[model samples]
Target: MTFEFEDRKHENTQLPNNLSAPNPGHTHQLISIMNTQKRDRFELLSAYLDGEVTATERRQVEEWLDKDVETQRLYSRLLNLRSNFQSLPVPSAQPVEQTIGQVFGKIDKRRRHRSVAWGGAAIAAMVVAALSSVVPGRQVWQMANVNNSAASEPLYVALNTPVVEIPDTVLAPAHKSAPAQPAKLHQQNN
Candidate 1:
């Protein structure tokens, strides 16, 4: 005995050709469904095709599709598009090395620019440090050695003072120096 898996009776059944055709008068129903912006006809058709809708929803979608020529055409186009994309060939090989080299070159260029900028900054900082040490106005204190008994003695002392002071005599008349002779002796005795 031989057994066949195909349903041979289905092929023999005299189904009407118009069974799958959209009804010419259902155009009004299709227009009404399309007018409802809440759910587009395409989405409804897709859900119905996927068997995701309830019995009532499925019936409504079927009726809408049957009535609407434009909706039916859109559904057919979507199905064709899906089939076309599914049949597309996938790429196998990738140019990974070339892509990596381009990325690495960009990275190296950026690193070099960054290093140059950092070197410039370091040089500027060194120049600023040198200037701070050498400039006259910034010298607020000095380490001085004091001599006692006319012998050289090293003394680490911080003297915080103005380098120069204007004397009252110097601000007075030029002859004020002669008038201060007696005061000089008094200062010496003190």
Candidate 2:
């Protein structure tokens, strides 16, 4: 395969031999498995640079770097890449406390909005329920109960039929409530 180099410095350097095997004439192959794939070589060298390899693997990599110019060149390029990444400017970040406070503030606001919405809904329901009984034809629940009772009676009412305890107030008309009595609180020592 043909080799291409973009940089003039790496012009005479070896090609990217990502093959499964190295040169048959190479002495390194006799020492260890130097005939590893190109990806394996890259990973091995990278791990070596990171100091993540075992003692045997480290020794092997060191030998490769010492004997082979290609390996040395690859290692040098990796080092340069790492240094370049390190030299890059890090973007400014929001403080932890500020971020957390903002999040909590949002949560509290949402909770307050939800509680207000629920309270409003409850008030609306109470208003509707109170008005329904007072307004003519708006007593939906009472009418529904009457229809349900007639349907459940089954043709005729017999003495043997189960008696349903209906409240006297239900049959009576609505009446005005008396004034509220002040609550009398009695405190006892525990």
Computed on alpha carbons, the lDDT of every model, listed in order, comes to: 0.67, 0.70
TM-score of each: 0.35, 0.33
* lDDT of model 1, residue 179: 55
Among these predicted structures, which one has the highest lDDT?
2
lDDT of 2: 0.70
The Cα RMSD of model 2 versus the native structure comes to 24.8
The superposed Cα distance between candidate 2 and the true structure at residue 99, in angstroms, equals 3.1
Question: Weakest 10 consecutive residues, lDDT, candidate 2?
Answer: 1-10
Worst 10 residues of 1 by lDDT: 1-10
For candidate 1, the per-residue lDDT at 72 reads 81
TM-score of 2: 0.33
Q: Which stretches of candidate 1 lie over 4 Å from their true place?
A: 1-66, 69-94, 146-190
lDDT of 2 by residue, 98-180 (tens): 99999999999999999999999999999988887788865355333345666776585667744787676876555766545
